[model samples]
Target: MKSNYFFRSIHAMRGLASFAVLISHSLTLYPFFEFRAAAAGVDIFFVISGIVMCLAIEEDTSKLDFIKKRIIRVVPLYWIATGLSVAYIYARYPHMSHSWDWIIRSFLFLPQQPGVDMPILYTGWSLNYEMFFYLILFLSLFIFKNAPIAAACIVAMIASFSAVGNLISYNYFFKQIFIEFSLGILIGYFLKFGGRVEKNLGIFLIFLALVIFFIHNKFASSGFLAWGVPSAMLILGAISFENSELFKRNFVKIFGDASYSLYLVHPLVIWGIEWYVLPEHRGILQVAIAIAISIFISIIFYKWVEKPLMRFLSKNL
Candidate 1:
């Protein structure tokens, strides 16, 4: 089946964002890389999740079915990665205490102690937020006639809470990060009904969004204020190019398809390099090799494991 160019653009951006996260962590070996802004990849992810949720879920789809499909999409690969992380931690630090509660919480997508965020897989921390947003979106389906209003309501609720200084007050629900999701929903609303801009105007909006991105980096520390809005604008701008030639590239679409695999599996790639490859060849060479190997392995893993499993589960579940 042919892929939608709009979604293809979104997915391609996802691949790029995932790569930014890989680079952000990998470049820690070189302090001169100066890519701290790449950490905003997570912000981009949250925005994408918010947007995709509103775009993908159908109006006729039941809430339970929606939740089940989300679980099928997210949980299986996550569990595999978490189990590997737990095993590695055990082998590496057998003397350290292993909290079953933490492991269970990680599996359940619950936040760890001190009311801060920690998951056994470490990167699974973002999955916690994803699951939280999914739950909210699922419930909203029961109460609202369409996904857009539900998304808008979510944004309004978070914005109001933020105004009252109650953001992040209700544990994880009212977090500042949720604002990104809200922004994404608003963008999704526009994409669903707002129609397209002229090609020149779209190009200008994209340029303006880039300017906002750099300005946010200069002035803002908060991810929501910094990268989130710019990320939303980028998505909006990218959608405007759905009918253009650039979005038709097959390589970009394939990279986007492998993005979820890259996101879930790159930590293992990093762990492998740190343990085996880095001690002997620890430099720019290793960084380059790590990136190449990570992407290669993620693509293979996606084709062999994630794609087949998701297809099976989608049919059976």
Candidate 2:
């Protein structure tokens, strides 16, 4: 039950999630409303990261290798994006200044300052949580060989501590988002190791979650359960086609490979367009232009910069 290679469905899910986030950001200029809920993509990503860590441990991976790969996968691109974000902020607000300490902490994947949500790169806020989760998984490697029990324990601890330590200073930065990762791990545990996941049940969860999303989209909810649990269900249903030929199509080619690039590149592209190209004319057309250019640039950066850097570091290290 615990054996399988790469799942195209998972990769495809990454592509879809990243695209959803990109769309959400592009809707920033809309006057009537903002598509902030598309940020459920981040929740989706959190769950995905948890599942990935679970998969890594199940593969009998070395803990050091797991950590090393995560660092390599995350750090270089994040640093570059941080540098770009700093430049963008300086240009956009010539008088506004970022704290040097915050910049350093951002690069280190540390939590944001009290009551602050975003980092230098804005989107890099999630990376802070990602790094923290990786730290847990790496340490958990010493004790738990299986992903399920470890995931259960993590979920319980987060729930218990959150209830008791709601006033803790750190909670300002940490919040309750940790549950998304735990949800993902539980899904991974159930699908990969524990037993069969019925297709009908997956379908029902997907439909029920969509209803929740639709309602939340109109009224807007604030809790992780509103977003995170739905995201987990989406992944649960999506990965049901993991072994199928669905994601291998040329047009649907796995943008999952470029997903990180998309995540880091789209905001810069969107902001640049808003600043330089069309400040006054904010409409659907403007969003179209931004998304087109962003995807193009992200692919280019992925091919020329990120891929080469990763390849070089993988070989050298």
Highest-scoring model, TM-score? 2
Error of 2 at 43 (Å): 0.9
| Candidate 1 Cα deviation (angstroms), residue 173 | 3.5
* Candidate 1 regions with alpha-carbon error over 4 angstroms: 1-6, 159-170, 218-220, 277-281
> What is the alpha-carbon lDDT for the whole of candidate 2?
0.77
The whole-model C-alpha lDDT of candidate 1 against the native structure comes to 0.76
- In model 2, where is the ten-residue run with the lowest total lDDT? 1-10
The collision pairs in model 1 are 168-174
lDDT of 1 at 222: 63
lDDT of candidate 1 at residue 223, scale 0 to 100: 49
Question: Residues 1-317, candidate 2, lDDT per residue (tens digit)?
Answer: 12473567777888888898988888875544656568888988988887776666754667778788888899999899889988888889998766887888888988767776678787898888788778778777777866445754776477556666556757743456777778777766665564544678867877887887888887878667788888888887776665567788654564888899999989898778778765576787788887888888988999999999999988887
Q: What lDDT would each prediction earn against the true structure?
A: 0.76, 0.77
* Per-model TM values vs. the true structure: 0.89, 0.90
